[model samples]
Target: MRVSANLGFLYADQPVTGRIASAARDGFDAVEFHWPYDVPPEQLRAALTAGGIQGVSINTRRGNLDAGDFGLAAVPGREDEARAGIAEAVDYAARAGLSAVHVMAGRAEGEAAGRIFVENLRFACEQAERHGITMLIEPLNLRDVPGYFLTGTDHARRIVAAVGHPTLRIMYDVYHMQIMQGDHVRTLQGLGDLVGHIQIASVPDRTEPDRGEVDIRWLLDQIAYSGLVGAEYHPTRAPGDWLRDFRSSS
Candidate 1:
């Protein structure tokens, strides 16, 4: 499994454009970005090229970090907003030469939201195809995101299945899944072909792999055997030290 770091959280003290550089300097295989539209595509591309790093994924958009707009992919009466978001993401990804974007199920929705959700997904998927990018929809946990409609692996899987398109897939985040649901391994196995990308952070503390309750190495091994790309996170300390545990033990 190739590793990637989410620049959203880590490298907070540095310029957002420096994210890819830091990830490369720290030995990350690739890096992912969250809500990076604010940064110009050419600048981002330049950073990626200079850092000698590849981008794993980038989010379509959000309501800024403070507003907690994880994404409005399934919200009711937001087709235009969703479409605009998709278009922007596709254009950005096309320019950046990125492979995927995380489609989010933002707010908790009522029955009406469900209908709108399907429509929004189909719309987004259709848009994603035009730019050769895959839309990876992520399900946030109720504890962290409380009321996010896409909260479970099964639901995410079902939604992707319903979309039934090549470009739409699930962003299987182990962190949220472990927090919202306990069975990570089972879900990964069950979800199977639908999982387009995977992310991980230890449960309870959202910290480095060794410090958390989940067995990070074991999970990586499982995901590796399954042939999935494992995106990255920042360690509170130097990454070499953190990853040393993995290398020596292996």
Candidate 2:
């Protein structure tokens, strides 16, 4: 029932890292960064240490988007390139004392692309073990990330099972799941422990928890009852205000 705030977009509007700590203090138990490599890892580590918070996870391979690389995992025939990116991500997360590395799966596709992604992902997972970091492969929705590969929960579950590694798991985002597929609860139930972490934003809008049609309080209850640690990972108009409504036992 611990709630980890998503600082990816939150930090964009509130650049000062301490402000994020204050938000977490308001109610959240921990915080997450989108891509810590984009910022100085030491600076973020200092902020987290000062604020008494935990940086749950962040993206390990978001390509220089403006540079046209969306990510590293799915580029056809680019295993080495993807591995290099993952190495950096692991280094940053390890230095920052993060618990997980959210692997950014690329939007690239096709049979050859799938092969590359699986190979590169397996390598990344092996590398992450040295850092003592669990790798969570995130699946972005096509609507938000058109052409991005790795968009289905069932398929992702299959991949994790096939890989058969405890450290490699899925970063199942509820918002993206609603868009790419339905039955969020069922999907998680199916995945079982293959799911390492979760991110949730309102469906259709990706905003505050209460803003979308999802009854996240109810969802949280389900997750808690199931004995999984579900973070409130999302953006909001007023992060604290949005957090105020969640009852741990609800």
lDDT (Cα atoms) of all candidates against the true structure = 0.74, 0.74
| TM-score to native of every candidate shown | 0.91, 0.90
lDDT of 1 by residue, 205-247 (tens): 7766665767867776664334334534556776546555655
User: Which residue runs of candidate 1 sit more than 4 Å off their true CA positions?
Assistant: 64-68, 223-234
Q: Which stretches of candidate 2 lie over 4 Å from their true place?
A: 224-236
Cα lDDT of model 2 by residue, 1-250, tens digit: 6667776655456674865677557777788876656568888888888888777777766766786677878787667778888888888888888888877778687887777777777887898898889988877788878888888987787668767777898888788888888787777777777778877777787776665768766775565233234344445456666666654325
Candidate 2: pairs in clash: 107-148, 107-149
CA lDDT of 155 in candidate 1? 80
Error of 2 at 9 (Å): 1.6
